[model samples]
Target: MNDSKPTPSFWKTPFGIGATVIAVAASIYLYIEHRNHLLALLPYAFLAACPLMHLFMHRGHGHGAHGHGQRDDTPKRD
Candidate 1:
């Protein structure tokens, strides 16, 4: 008796084809309906991304050694 399962064909499967059609249709509809609104928000999105980029980019920096050659406040015993 054979015991082999059918392999999935991603883009050719029913769900895959349906999802592609739905995505394409939604993209077309949104572009036609809200293109101007989306374009207006582009500059604000860029402005917000600038500070986030700097914070993330410099997160791994400014970590130098400290407490070198500095005297402690407590007195030393003879």
Candidate 2:
């Protein structure tokens, strides 16, 4: 029974820690530097999110709790 677990990846190494810190710092710096530019896109971002949110939340929607995926004899919506 080969039960050996896989080795830890990048995040577990010292170099990875440094890289993560640099990435976070760069992100914060860029956001602060271009805060106005990012803010200008908020409305478009909100519009884009509507359809995405609807698509995810509406999965298996008509199928409810007990009657999921089973079709009804009558062509009527429950």
- The lDDT leader among the candidates is 2
Residue-wise lDDT of candidate 1 within 1-78, one digit each (tens)?
A: 879988788888899999999999998998899999988999999999999998898775443323667655555454
Q: Write the per-residue lDDT of candidate 2 for residues 1-78, one digit (tens) a residue.
A: 999999889898899999999999998997999999889988999999999999898986655544766666765565
Instruction: List TM-scores for all candidates, in order.
Output: 0.45, 0.45
In angstroms, the error of model 1 at 22 is 0.4
Which residues of candidate 1, in runs, are more than 4 Å off? 1-6, 43-78
Q: Which candidate comes out best when scored by TM-score?
A: 1
Give the C-alpha miss distance for residue 10 in model 1, angstroms: 2.9
lDDT of 1 at 46: 100
Span of ten consecutive residues with least summed lDDT in model 1: 60-69
- How many residue pairs clash in all the candidates, one count each? 0, 0
